[model samples]
Target: MQQPPSHAREILRLAVPAFGALIAEPLFLLADSAIVGHLGVAQLAGVGLASAVLHTAVGLMVFLAYSTTPAVARAMGHGQLGKALAAGRDGVWLALLLGIVLAVAGFWAAEPLVALMGAEGDVRSFAVDYLRWSMPGLVAMLLIFAGTGVLRGLQDTRTPLLVATAGFALNVVPNLWLVYGLGWSVAGSAAGTSVAQWAMASVYLVMVQRNAARHGISLWPDWSGIRAMTRVGSWLMLRTLSLRIAILATVFVVTGQGAVNLAAHQLAMTIFSFLAFALDALAIAAQALIGKELGASNSVRARQLTGTMIRWGAGFGVVTGTLLAVAAPWAGALFTSDAGVQSVLTYALWILAAGQPIAGYVFVLDGVLIGAGDAKYLALAGVANLAAYVPMLVAVA
Candidate 1:
């Protein structure tokens, strides 16, 4: 699919930094595997299981970003700089609230949750320790995630990506020291990742403030505007939580089956994540563009933006998914040397990659809906799918 007339260049403008920033995200995961991978499959497997659970829980609060992005963009589009800045402040408040709640729960429940994943012995100990040390990162991750959303909404993906890239680069050195030099095991990896996230979050916040100031937006919160954010954010929070739960449930069920299966699924998932997240960046671009277009009161432009995003998503699916399908063996090697894991991961990657075009449509359609502030449907759609995904996973297994 050709871009929307220089569309490719325009999209790349947002996507490049975004992709670079997001590269750190995969590094965060790959680092997790690299650390635990050396510890033995059992340890790797246990952290993998716990990480899935922890991410879902953190995802629950990520509504801060999913909800805030389009809104901020709309305000910016309408030339309501004050309102846009207010959105930023309220976002920090709401994200921190959700973060604090998640942090306390994650720390307290890390042990029991890892145990429930069926992890045992030293593996369980490693998972618990990793979670305990890594819980702080969840807050930072959410905040940074939401902050990125705000910036992207304004059609400024470059800054977030730059911040992400810097943080990701800084992470490698400390990780090497902790994992190989000091032999701190999985905890070292977790610590390294946590520190990296902290750096990213701080950079994002600073960048947003500077951008707002330069753009003449008030850098403080407005109570009245915050109420509007609340109204919009409520539906978003639910929608994000539902999506998070659905993915979480996928991990949960896979774990219940066994460690080998769970590890395979995780490896497949990590590989699939590259395509999914990359496509999401396209969705992010669409959300930023369409919402701002709508806020400019040009529904026609908004609809056009939506159409382009869907087209780009399909094109992206074909290109990126094909690459992943071809590279399945290499991805498996990156995770582990287990023959069972390699086989399962290889098969699962094909299944997921084949579905990318379909999944791509769903994700981009989601961006369209969210951009319109029609996120109620996103939540409802997931709830509606509970029956289908649950039964399908069981039947497929």
Candidate 2:
């Protein structure tokens, strides 16, 4: 057998830290779900709907990280430190501007959005309250996303790992205090999360500022640079939005099935998302390494890195999938005791496990292409994928 690549160590260094950072947010949400679950099914359902909306909104702006990583990595790879820092700063500006717009829109549109999701009665009311209260946090989330991008581009995943770890640790105390100690219910969970998010964003801003000062880069926005970032970001946004639509469509279909189905789906999804952390970390490493190599005009090394990542991703997926399959018997017990929910979740876990290897390949390929700056093709592919998935969903429904 061929020996493993000598650079496997570098990939692990990046992937491990990136994985920690990636899992932080989901872990926070999982904590919230666990706490709110005891309050009753309606509240849990409410939190699920609100979370779906918040996730979709934030997911659409993930380009803040995705676009900045490649742009900054490419610039830095070419030894243009100043330009790299400048590009990162532009991403921050764009993130702030877009965050404000999205916060306001999502807040005001919360009720109708929930209604459109087929939520009703107490579920709708609770979802609206949670979503509206969480809007400010979305701003913090967007800022953190962009700042994390800047740090990743400079080849420093450790900082994000530290910050995310600290932030997530801080989240649990407030969540418990507000949700149980103070009796705020689902709204309290939202409040605690919002506070934690802003705290994380504040820390990230300080770090970014110090880095900028160290490099003698201006903190002020550059319209031209911002526009350039947006040019790439727009395509990413489209691709991201298309993915969200696919998820939203799935949620809609599940909702029509009834509250029990939706809740079970939510639990299964949470598990799937947690597993994605590993794949995502590898993908992130691929993005940074591939972008850096391509930026240095080392196409051959970039290809080699891509190949290595795909292999690792597949191997990791198989391992994770096996674990998921073994744990499937006990996975449902952790989320809920409801017979109906548990029944559905058992099968869902197996399905999710079986698909893990395919997911791993797709995730790795996606990051490689994104790092190659093939945003337009990715956008078109997302649309096509959605077009295909929708009909299948309809058929199943």
For 1-397, candidate 1 gives per-residue lDDT tens digits of: 3336765666667766776665567767776786567566666776777677777776666667777888888988899876776687678766666778888988999999887766777767877988887888888988897788788777888888778778877777787788788988777878888898898888777876786788786756666765776777677667666666667767767766776787787666666665667777777777777788889999876766677778877887888778878987667777787888878888888888788888777778887788788888887777777756777777754
TM-score of 1: 0.92
Instruction: Score candidate 1 by lDDT.
Output: 0.76
**TM-score top scorer:** 2
- All predictions: root-mean-square deviation over Cα? 2.4, 1.3
Which ranges of candidate 2 are over 4 A from the true structure?
Answer: 1-5
Error of 2 at 213 (Å): 1.2
Summarize candidate 2's per-residue lDDT along 1-397 as a digit string, tens digits.
Answer: 3435566877888889999999988888888877777777678778888888888999999999999998888988899999988888888888899999999999889999999999888888888988998998999999999999988888889989998898888888998898899998888889898898999999888988888899899999999998988888899899999988998888889878887788778877777778887689988888898889999999988887788889888988898999999998887677677778778878989999999998888888888888899989999999999999998999988
Clashing pairs in 1: none
Root mean square deviation (Cα) for candidate 2: 1.3
| Every candidate's lDDT | 0.76, 0.87
